[model samples]
Target: MSHFTQLRTKITELEHLVAALADVGYATVETHDEARPLRGYQGDRRRQRAHVIVRRQHVGAASNDLGFERQEDGTFRAWISEYDVRELGAGWLGRVEARYAYHATRATLARQGFSVAREETDRDGTVRLVLTRQATGF
Candidate 1:
């Protein structure tokens, strides 16, 4: 039986979340205002409501949608089918979270007048970034 599993995330801004998903090559549909029912493998609507929908265009003939719900504390949680998770690849959520963090961090730094000085990706896909604040002459 396929079911949606909620995964916790620290994403608050809908725009950032959407941009982060896109940064990692995900097709997303924002539905924060109108919560949509998540469907199962048999095309049955589940009780879970999604603020944002992550659509897998190539998941078999029927595209599967992953729902992301907003928490009371302004965070977000994702509801995804276990089958689709495996199909996307191992540690799919972890990868998405990491990419989201990367984009969010970069945006924050840019807003603070900081530029990326150096970036390194470890063998285990851990990102290390060096940010340098721009100097202003008096």
Candidate 2:
């Protein structure tokens, strides 16, 4: 039986999601055009699938694959096992969310011709970004 449970998130962009995972130290995340099966704790493939996956090997010896499945609403939801949640801590997803927000904001700003003039991270893992845009005409 699969122990994975789906958790809703506000993530909508794939590129930003991948970059966010990388920022959180998951550099080997796999992305597929189609959903792929996730590996269980016993190394067996479960029916659960996702577009973005962090393999079981990367999670832990007894942990299942961590995944983000794209929903019909254009957002992505996380699929994580209960055991893995306990091992990875309850705040793990929060960290990923913060990083996702950071990347997404930066990308949006860049598209609007805004550049990061200053960036700071506090001891509590809060990120502060100061953006500046050039004047089109003076």
Candidate 3:
């Protein structure tokens, strides 16, 4: 039996989401143009599908696959098994979200010709970034 739970998230960009996963140590995440099936506890394919997936092998021996589906509004929704959630703990998602925001902000700033002048993280996991842009002469 499958025990996947759907969770909504504010992640709207696929590239940022992938990069965020990598930043959080999930380097082998799979991305597809269309949603693909997720595996269950027994390595059986479940009916649920997602555009971005972290395979069961990467999660744990007893854990099911982790997935993120793209929504109509361009955001992604997470589909994580209840078993995996307990294994990963509650803070797992929060960390991913925080990293997502970090990457998104950095990418946006880079596009605007801004460079990261300083970056730091507190003991409490709070990230601070300082950006600067070169002055253009007329």
Residues 1-138 of candidate 1 have per-residue lDDT tens digits of: 675677888888777777767766675465668677877666777898888876545244454577788888989888888787777776777777877787888888899999989999999988888888878999
For each candidate, what TM-score against the reference?
0.79, 0.95, 0.95
Model 3, runs deviating above 4 Å: none
Task: Please give the distance, in angstroms, between residue 16's alpha carbon in candidate 1 and its true position after superposition.
Answer: 2.6
Where does candidate 1 stray beyond 4 Å? 56-63, 117-123
lDDT of 3 by residue, 27-48 (tens): 9999999999999989898988
Cα lDDT of model 2 by residue, 1-138, tens digit: 448989999999999888988988788999998999998988898888999999988878888999999999999989999998889899888889888999988888999999999999999988888889999986
lDDT scores in order: 0.76, 0.91, 0.91
Model 3 per-residue lDDT at 102 = 88
User: Candidate 3 — worst ten consecutive residues by lDDT sum?
Assistant: 56-65
> Candidate 3 at residue 133, lDDT?
97
The alpha-carbon deviation from the true structure for residue 51 of candidate 2, after best TM-score superposition, in angstroms, is: 0.7
Arrange candidates, best TM-score first. 3, 2, 1
